[model samples]
Target: MSFGPPPSLYTQSSVAADQRRRKRRRTVLLCAVAAVVAPALAVGAWLWWPGTASDDAKPTAAPAQHRLDVRETVERRPASTQGVMAVRLSTDDLPPGEAHEMPGLWATDKILAKGINRTLVGVAIGTDAGLGEEAWKLRLGGPICGKTRHVTVENRTAVLFRDSADKESLCNHVAFVDLDDGKLVWQAEFPVSGYVDKPDAGSQWDPGVTLTHATVTVTWGDGTDAYDMDRGKLRWRVTSREDCISQGAGGGRALAVRFRCYDADDPQSRSTFEIRALDPRTGRSRWTYTPAVGVKDVRIISTTPTVLATSAGDVGITEIISLDARGKYRTTIPLQGGAYVAECTDEITYLATEECPSLAVGAGQVFLTSKEQGDLIHNANWIIGFDLKTGHSVKKFESGPNTLLRPLRMSGDRLLALRESSDRISPMALVSLNPRTGAETPYFYFSLPQEGELFSTTEFADTVVQNGRLFFGAKEAQGPADADSKAWVWLAFGIESAAAKKP
Candidate 1:
């Protein structure tokens, strides 16, 4: 959840998902597949990308098609990292040479990212999302300034962002934006001052929002506020408790909230965590759920239309719990270990494991990747899909088995898997599967140039999949961090043409 913090920053493990899926697969077929697939993927890596001399030692087998096309090359370091140079080309069909360039001012500054209508705002590093609709090359007006965290998309038409460049994380201002172009619909400041500082982690908590089908709710500091999305006017505001400070909140559900109330004076006093659901209209308490004894500071893992997913534990163990909208316990999915994987990613909250996904909630189900609790990556396998109604296993699939095959996206009907390089030695691939039947189909694949290495973990953001495309950012190194210096490359892969079988 901290993503540990990438000013140019943001980070998944899939191991957990593998074990959960393996438990249900009592069959020898899946067991055998798990035993063999990973090395096979690694063995196959050299075929996709050219590598150092070692790769050359092996004979090359020509593949049917090249996975990706280099439309344009990014400039370098600061320019490439800032959101300005990000949207150089929109996905929409464009002229042969029209490309976007960054304003020199943003080279060292940070850029926030948010995805909408398959298009990205602030950061459009490359057109991997697609290359036909008209590329989204939006430039931020000089008015909005912030170390750029992310834009909270309220709807297809508008987005909200905290525009304070102050690293203190205070909310001096917020910008309501139009998706058609990078135009500010409205920019306003919170009536009060300071956004609480999570100084221990070197991060700030600004107002977080929740949007329902009709209303908008935001969590600023210790309280909640409601706004009219169309007019940008405050409808209601709830001041936080005098003794309790609000630590975190979540949105993107049904305009509902599960706010964290902590000791205002000490902030770190997590001995007790109070989760309350607030009325989106009046900011009044609708319901509150308190953790049972032994489990302190129950934190939200994710929220869905049918359930509120959470994690809590006593010492070093963490357990996943699900509650209905009314805050009634549905069931519990127990997990081992602590310290969820932190990522410098946008739009994801739960931490994943080394081999499986950390967690996914959608389509009336909950998903989790187990930690490397017992075995390491090469041996761990399974991904569990749990019923949101009973918190029981709905289905299990032999996730990556020997491979780091991760569920990158979970929609209402299907799950998309992206196979990535683990040691940076394997070639990355993508596939899609039916959560119900476990049917697999090759979606796409790409190779890193043999000359470069994957970026440092801190600069890496998880892959974003939408509109038949995959968008990923990586920091490349010619040497070490101080060596040839650091540069970034954003990869966009169009998967529409090869969703059925490998080309």
Candidate 2:
């Protein structure tokens, strides 16, 4: 079944697995010894960066151990709404010409890395501590076709790119890049045949790549291959059956593949989509789960819990399916009406893993944001968590009438949400929500220049909350409308410091 487009310029959310686990563990430990966290402050007068008191706040290189301990820092003064290090990236030094589609964005304790399309080729660019300066750059041979949000403990991740600068070159090359050193550790190329350019006919069959702790798996046209994460040596290979085609693979703590099989008698008449779990170290199938017969799209939410967002006969995601470790169906949460929005985009067709932008799964619950209730002046929203095994709404965090809450990332047992800047009267803030107590603690507050505010949304840019800072980077940058005119395209911007200033 064809969902829509591939994971191209519009793919929304992605996070490295290693980074998440480390932060989760650190957050849990920090909360145990920290003092009681304070509540958020009242909304302050709209204030922009630079040329104001907020300008005095500067970005500093955070200590290594404090990277994931953002909760502890906020507890000292949780209600602060003052700005700190407000770094805005107007445009980088990359040769300016036509617009470029910037694909991936990842962050570490010391640097923030972004994917750039430099003249049709893929270039990985890094900045030191949100300074907006290029610390290093790695030029992939061609435009990045796909990438895995999972990173190894040593800060290594994989990316998929084309073989040459030719626009028609298929994305058949995969490489592992070291984020800390900004170096390409290893790369390998696989050949794919009988490729189709149409979604319905199987353009989603393009080679896809994903990373696990010990393995990097890629799906060629007909089958799948698993390689060692450190070295590019092939660990195991699985060829597809004569009547089946492997769509792609997704990985985290475990690996899973989604493919379809056709009837031997009539290839066009029969179709069945299946998802199978494979051991990361070896290529053995552990369990398989098949959705209802006509489920058109299936996106992997989390591999460990085996959650999937599926659309049956309808267009967008109609429900969320939870499965047990043994592949047994646990529960199905129906989303037929417009009460809740998971933000699953149709453009994420190929390697459709990790595509649910507005949903977070953890602590035996799947958290989702409720639909907005009001208009521009008084927008209302809330985040509700549902038990994965019982499909019951267990927790709810409201976004007061002035702001809307969007889940950014999960920290330990808490969920980090972006409190959207409602209007010129209010500023955007970050808060951590507790599933157990329903308590929300404010992290920091900052506002973008009037012109730079639009890019702050997750749809227009990529977001990263690290080292007690929140960053928003453009997903794509277009050149000047003409040669003589300039465009207000922001490459990236970040907010730090949560210490409230005297009102």
Candidate 3:
């Protein structure tokens, strides 16, 4: 999905806020130095050095500053994948149309959507039936015009869509629509910044939206709020505690949020890391965990209901630190070959690049990606499985050499990995690996529209496994412009991979 900033947004106020914050920070730093440094020096002189030295010997050369000790690549033992079948899904050769609109030159256009969502159809081979509606029509067109910017499938029969009413016009509302009749079930106007006017680069404070159990929990730049599914009423609202800042936060299917809290003054220091679980409805803390010693801070890699996966370390050296449901430490997987977890967030903060998440949480295991020696040259990535209950290393699976692999969503109990095709004429492929047995099924292709050179670099985002089907959105270009505009594509990788027609 297009997780980057919109083409144009009114960011002058945001920029002014930053300037004010910088002034406050400089004032605070100067006060902190004056309050502590002079007292500390007097104490040191009185106790340690009672008399001043007449002449000091030549000072030894100062020690070199510490730099991030990150290795470019690490080698790994190859693992075998046998007894798996390669499968590809049919897209019906449907292409997307323009989803973003531009009104004028001075005014920014509000009709921008990240991507569309469509269901995966897995029919039997040679028994193809036509789709009820054009896939893009199912997600983008029809009742909604160019003003609609965000649309998410709430359930089989309903969807959540946000239009220009809120961010662009100050009447922003996130409305739920019944898919069968296209009627608004309810709509909510969040308290903070309206429907995403722009995407943040990456910051501790940003917006994250998730819907579960007919409840919508939104964490925006200022605070977190939860709304009832029906009638769109506020259930709970919360702001961060003093001296602490709200970092990245997200929720799973269960509607529970593992919100991150960091010390505002020193986000990179030893005491900055903190994590806690919140009951979305109540806006109350359920459990909390703070790592001790040697770890500077904690970043969420991924999480399941029972397991929270994260990477902990100082600088680039990191170890996988998993915690159980109660927020107790489960196990610490030490730095394996000096590698850290690479992560990316669906709700990217403003001005931030994608994150490097170290691991992903799966059904019965936590999945970790490790770089082979060839990863530096090509996309040779591997997956390592750890038992969920015990947090123990279980198995390793490889997607062969000279190919890059990315962990997508889990289908049933198997972990789905996207295999980036190396051949110029070939499209990307998909593989499924049973986390328990380390058995990988190979080579499933999506009949996506071929965009020539852009197809190879096209990245998929907002991947969700819903109603036994996989739905994800992709954008050829991140944002829309009057000069050059592109539409969004929604690909549904059907569960049934029979002999389907190629694109």
Candidate 4:
């Protein structure tokens, strides 16, 4: 399914006609609502909102706590690369495969693997599959550049690459291969010229990924494309004026995408932002909303076929907008500074900002962090909580200066914040934060070999939290002062709640 702008700009007469048509539709919908409201209002007026209190209202029990356990950890490295790098995880434990080397190396570039432990897909300058010396490599028809921006796993069957084939044109291609055996299943290419940028321009950003039951949606900057994973064929293409920024799958068998279109005259300024929800199977527009343009830090919070959008105003004013079934403005709620929202349940929303602010339909409570005045410093770190619905600060906690906190995952009542020293020269530490109480408890701190000296250029890879354990990989290289560094090592750590305190 595809969508595009009108063939040409609308004339004055056309604009007036569209307005009249929309206005008439609104009138009919309003009349239909009024006709049914008289009888429904009597029963609804007496029913209290789920979270509110009433004389007959009774509190529901909290959900049962699930224990998180670390099952296993296996380290895999590519051949030729000195660093034991590129670790992919799957649900089942698999043997450590031989490391494969790609053609290019960039600080921001990454290798993706499908599944938990098994090597389902791999891509670099060319492509390869399987494990160890038994792995097979396939040479693409053309010289595969290492500068590919976004590579995604599709339907556990194929890999998609945003390839820059020429100086003026950007092309998207997919390589479908068998997951068990390294065999080419199929390949398709789409050429795009308008949004293409020079290699040095860096306008090509991360592409969006949305996988439906039947098709996988791959949205590039100014164009949207879908692939029938089962058949390995192109479904449709939708081109737009702006770069598609984000996308999400809603419950009502619909897919939503957001994009920003800038005014051509003022290239530095954006003129409009649009959110469109489409039927995933047919590629038909179900609803569209074009909000005011001043929302500088717009981010898509959630999207459902019935409930289309949730977004923040900007970094400073944390106001969230929610759209209704008709693609019309529904409600707006103020959020706290640095508030982060995540989809917790199908019907409820969870937020974990500085501290942790949460809300739900039947029951909800706010968790906050606290600190002392002496803890304040120019670069000091702290975490706080606020009420998501009310925008009120609930609590605050001090984490000390030069401390970096990365959220691994949240499970049950525990919100794990991986704490490490900002000073790359020092050892790393892990800290756990409780979302319910705003308490930060240091879990484990480990030191690397001081003589080797930490590689300042290498970043401590972000940690992943699953089940109940935190996983992280660290890279270190060593060499003579004047010579190029050759010695490299990648270390994986599995962290769990400590049963006994260390002396």
Instruction: Identify the candidate with maximal lDDT.
Output: 2
Q: Would you estimate the TM-scores of all the predictions?
A: 0.59, 0.78, 0.55, 0.48
lDDT of 2 by residue, 42-79 (tens): 34424332211221222222224321111111222234
**In candidate 4, which residue ranges exceed 4 Å CA deviation?**
1-159, 162-171, 175-187, 195-207, 212-214, 241-254, 263-269, 301-380, 385-388, 393-404, 410-414, 421-460, 467-469, 473-481, 489-503
Candidate 4 lDDT over 157-267, as tens digits, reads 333443442422232555544433445666667443333454322444334444444555666555667777556677877776543443222211246666666766676
Cα lDDT tens digits, model 1, 11-92, are: 0111112444434422322223221113334444234322111111111222232111101111111111001112221121
Judged by lDDT relative to the true structure, which candidate is superior, 2 or 4? 2
Provide the RMSD of all predictions against the true structure, rounded to 1 decimal. 16.0, 12.1, 22.7, 22.7
Top TM-score hit: 2
Candidate 4, lDDT over the whole model: 0.36
lDDT of 2 at 201: 21
- Look at candidate 2 and give me any clashing residue pairs: none
**Candidate 4 least-lDDT 10 residues:** 1-10
Model 4 C-alpha RMSD to native: 22.7
By the lDDT metric, which is better: model 1 or model 4?
1
lDDT winner between 1 and 2, please give it: 2
- Runs of candidate 2 with Cα error greater than 4 angstroms are 1-81, 86-88, 92-97, 118-133, 195-204, 264-267, 345-350, 498-503
Cα deviation at 124, candidate 2, in Å, is 13
